[model samples]
Target: MISTVPHNVRGVAASCPQCTSSLGRIWHPDMRIPRGWALAAGLFYLLALAGPFVQISIFGRLQRADIATGPLQLTVQGFDLVGFLVLAVTIIFPGIKLGIVLLTLFGIRLEHQPTRFLKAIFRWYPLIGPWAMVDVYLLGFLVAYTRLTAMATVHLDLSLFALVGLMISMAALDGSLDTGAIWDALDTGPAPRPIDADHRGGHLIGCHCCFLINRAEPGMACTRCDTVLRDRKPDSIVRSWAFVIAAMALYIPANLYPVMLITQLARTTPFTIMGGIVELFAAGLWPLGLLVLLASIAIPLVKLLSMACMLIEAQRPSGRHLLGLTRTYRFVAFIGRWSMIDVFMVSILVALVRFGQFANVQASTGAACFAGVVVITMFAVESFDPRLMWDGAREAAPETPPDPTLIAEPA
Candidate 1:
């Protein structure tokens, strides 16, 4: 028997404490607030893209960098993949993300509900949201800023200020926007299949995108969002293991080789990931140094080890501390992308510090390797279904017998 719960205008279902499966949010969704923030973000984003991001004066030669300069610089220096990744995350993806939100909100305002086109576009918002990394890019800019000022006379450009505004507006947009509410507003479809009175129990699948709970078979699409309803992610174990292994292999080269080559006065010096961190500390920027150390080095290693442990536990199915493990998985997923900080920093440096033989920064093999590690670990986290751990624990647990004392006697 299938029963679709009516969309609660207030909010979605509360999270399941036992499994850490979130069916809805605690706070109410406010559309008006987020729309304003989105508009602000859009304005800021446009300003950010329109002007020079930063400028450096080295030996009286002026070099100004635009938002696209970093990626182009990296590509010119032969790190095409890294450059593409930077361009996508910083320029392409962020714009796409804002466009999606602004378009959806605009559609909602016009139609007073979601259209078919809006539904299709909104589906990607959650997936693309994480990769639109302006905030993280700002932090990377901070680290890069320290290095730039140390080497030459640096000037913060209009684009830099605009990027700061964009970052803040994006952050605000994220916090105020209730995606569940948006989904609820979009669900103008037919009523769901009625429940069977005789049937009492069935597995409920929650839409990973919209968090819409559906009482349906695994292959069926979600009633609310039309996303495929899977009881669990397909090949969750194997895919996660593959990514983890790949990341683990790349981690070695990522740390061993120099991430960038610093050339000054015709002399080039290679700086490994650790060497960069040490340099930051030596420059008395301990806080920024610590931030980089944790993001670039510690976070990646922790994610790798934590994922390995979780995968092993999922395979074994220990019912112990499942909640803690689930929370840990969430944490791992959240922080996985921050490892890109160093990569962003490198791209910025490579773009701004181009003074021929006087000063130049070139991304090397290790930067690419470390970037691979960060991206692969992120994939590993995404592919590994946390629900699998809970499922394993449930399967391993002993079944409880029903008590006969409560049984009713028939005459």
Candidate 2:
């Protein structure tokens, strides 16, 4: 019994961002991605493959970029660490993931039966899908590098074009692929089973500590949490509080340390993530400033509070706004990763802006851990299933005649 959002709010009239449509195509059992996107992706990939993505003329001799050499340049520039991770997250993973997605799409293209490889790819889709961050990375990088490019002469190369292709392919794959629709295409089964009713009346069935849902019975052996059925709220609250404390500890270092460092011409300028937002604000770019603050600072803090609120709600289900708060919690968690803009800016700066003698910029040490923090909190958020908010409603689904004996139980 998931608390259904009002139909009015549930659908946002999701349209193609480029071409505004009041009504976006309904994602359905038989839906396939539009063909225009595939053509665009193919063209972009070919364009990216054409020639030197980057060109460097040192003392009159010129060098070019290929898939391998793009990262090699970063390695030589003392930004080997950031480059390696980008290689994995942006380049390698998007290629593999989109390849898998395109493979599935081609099955539809040819109207041929998909092979076992297609099935394996479909299964891996959930994990692979979220990692396609190259475009996001590209955006962040370009923003930061714009300031860097004014100081140097940098040339584009074959790998740069390939990177662009990678971005397009990823976008096309995302636009075309739909999980529910894909499952239908592959004959995958229905969504997971809903949680059973909470006999005790409180909506929460699972412990935050161990994800153990069913309440402990008289002699039932608990496989994960060995708690002896005393009070669910007390145990869960304590463990969740501990995690909150750990996140708090990490938050301090994540902010204080330079989130990214811009070094050029033997000079290093450190910009904490907060510092970057401050720069935006000082420049009077209010909208971008607001966007950054929300993404980087406000949202993460709100999410932390939302997680804390879950503990609060579990302990005292008396709150009237639990349903809305739970939804808000999920939304905050959903948007939390976009805070990686600062890190992405660092990558773009490193990749696009190359000035050997006068100036150059590279990401600092803290960016990785900060990325780790975002990812860690992301996993934590995912592990927490919001559907539990309505677990108690399962029993409430079929409204019964009021019984004088049954009083409304406190959450």
Best by TM-score: 1
| TM-scores vs. true structure, each candidate | 0.91, 0.65
- When summed lDDT is taken over every stretch of 10 residues in candidate 1, the lowest stretch is 402-411
Angstrom error of the Cα, residue 236, model 2: value is 10
RMSD of 1: 5.8
Clash totals for all candidate models: 0, 12
Q: Write the per-residue lDDT of candidate 2 for residues 279-303, one digit (tens) a residue.
A: 8778776676777677667766777
User: lDDT for each of the candidates?
Assistant: 0.85, 0.55
Which residue ranges in model 2 land beyond 4 Å of their true spot? 2-84, 108-117, 154-178, 188-246, 281-288, 352-357, 392-411
Q: C-alpha displacement of 194 in model 1, angstroms?
A: 7.5
- CA lDDT, candidate 2, residue 186: 58
Q: lDDT tens string, model 1, 1-411?
A: 122233433434544434534444535566889999999999999999998988989889999998799999999999999999999999999999999999998788774554778988999998898899898999999999999998899888888899999999999998888786787678887755544544445766767777766778899988777889887889999999999999999999999999999999999999999999999999999999999999999999999999998999889988887778888898999998899999999999999998878999999999999999999998999899877876777688855522211111111
After superposition, the stretches of candidate 1 with alpha carbons farther than 4 Å from their true spots are: 1-13, 20-23, 112-114, 193-203, 399-411
- Model 2 RMSD, rounded to 1 decimal: 9.6
